[model samples]
Target: MRAIFFDETDAQAVVARLRADGFEAALERERLAGEDDDEDHPWAVVSDAPAFMLEVLVDTHDGWLDEGDDDAGEHTTPLAPLDLPTAPRTVKRPDLG
Candidate 1:
């Protein structure tokens, strides 16, 4: 699943942690604050692992998974493309048969 993390620290820490945890992760800076080049920049990541993730946000630090404590189970799937704001776009049918 695609996850967006907003924090004041460089995403390298989290990226490294995720990699160590055997996840396919990457860190990319956001261009919103014109401080992307700095070590402390806002970043996002897309990971295939469904395990819990730790992040230090501007307000607090914590680790959490999409699934709750119930532990029914969690699965990762591709993110759907967002539709345009001005139109109701059609979802292409896939050849699943």
Candidate 2:
């Protein structure tokens, strides 16, 4: 289960509450692409809590909850190739005469 909150404080508070209730909850900060400011980022709550409990908690806090696969909403991008030397090179020593 997962939820997103626009406020960090609220997210943390929820996480605390869930922990107090014996739920395995974790908080994370998410910043989407093209968002340059830290204030624009949102906080996320991930938990192994049941649907009923999650629903109640989210409803009580007026938060948006997204229930789906654990990896849902995660973005993946391909890595670019880099050009570099694959073998060691030897350098000749200069005479000091």
Candidate 3:
């Protein structure tokens, strides 16, 4: 999960809290396309914290959650089985043995 914050302090705070609570968390720079200002890039809190926990933090920090890929939460079908020969083939026409 990812949460974006305009304030670096807020992003750091959230990461600290998540770590204290025993969840994997880290901070990074989030660059949005068309944003020419290099210093204006937002800070992102990347974490394995629960959605509810991150949602509350995002609300308090004036940021939003970037829930990546709409289809990411959906289930995917398993791979199809492969076809095989009815019997094992003989090795070297059974003459090398």
Candidate 4:
């Protein structure tokens, strides 16, 4: 699957994390037309991992994935956090008198 990232660093970070997690990932430079050298262009992250896993990574790291097709045609959305089956967190507040 392919997903758009903000910049090369973010793309590389995703690739590194995926590789560390035992998934193959790579980045492809996507330059827009009429963009100058100084302008920031986005990169696309390509991975061979499962969609769910990619989604999780994207969600946790603030990335976005391509959601192909709907009544309104193709669109992209930020990955939503998965509902993991885990224990809830406990927060302790400081005693303020």
Candidate 5:
């Protein structure tokens, strides 16, 4: 199980808690391309814990899971494209009486 955390303190807390619970966990830096700010890089926690266990911790710590790098196995369906108008939106529509 893997979790990405924006706060270093949260990441460390998770790691400590997991270790205390007899689970193997490791914390590392998660860097993405085009991310110029070094301090903005999120922290990654890789552990041998179960998904549910990790999910609970992640939810409580304001973090999210990194379910591999593949989006092919995702079950979610993509939403239809929005047809946005090019012109400025009016404050009041004539049809809304």
Candidate 6:
């Protein structure tokens, strides 16, 4: 998932635009960890900073979308996992067989 930060003011507009353009976009209003809400959280999930910021989460697969059915607001398909690159780690090699 990619989080593209945009100016707070245009967050909603951007999200709407992306949705219209057949892209996966959403406004993150709260932290899922159940922590105390901080001042950083935008009241409307949109910012009013110098510029509007948007977090664009690209779909890893077409499955994330609802099979392209024409039903409005009918999200039946499950959200697919985002493609992520494997972390790089060094492993010591033992004696070869």
Best by TM-score: 3
lDDT by candidate, in order shown: 0.52, 0.82, 0.91, 0.76, 0.92, 0.41
Reference-based TM-score of each model: 0.38, 0.63, 0.71, 0.56, 0.69, 0.29
Lowest-lDDT window of 10 residues in candidate 4? 68-77
Q: Which has the better lDDT: candidate 4, or candidate 5? A: 5
Put the candidates in lDDT order, highest first: 5, 3, 2, 4, 1, 6
Give the clash count for model 3.
0
Rank by TM-score, descending? Answer: 3, 5, 2, 4, 1, 6
3 or 4: which has the higher TM-score?
3
* Residue-level lDDT tens digits of model 4 in 1-97: 7767776777788899889989888888767688897447778787878899888877866778866452233345557899995887877777852
lDDT tens readout by residue for model 3, 5-70: 999999999999999999999999998999999999999898989999999999998999999873
2 versus 3: better lDDT goes to:
3
Give me the overall lDDT of model 3. 0.91
Model 1 lDDT per residue over 1-97, tens place: 4344556243465666668889887766545555655655446655655544443321133322233332233445547898668867778768853
lDDT of 6 by residue, 1-97 (tens): 2233324545465566657656566666434355575645442232222121232221211111122243434557667899886997777778752
Q: In lDDT terms, which candidate is top? A: 5
TM-score of 1: 0.38
Candidate 3: pairs in clash: none
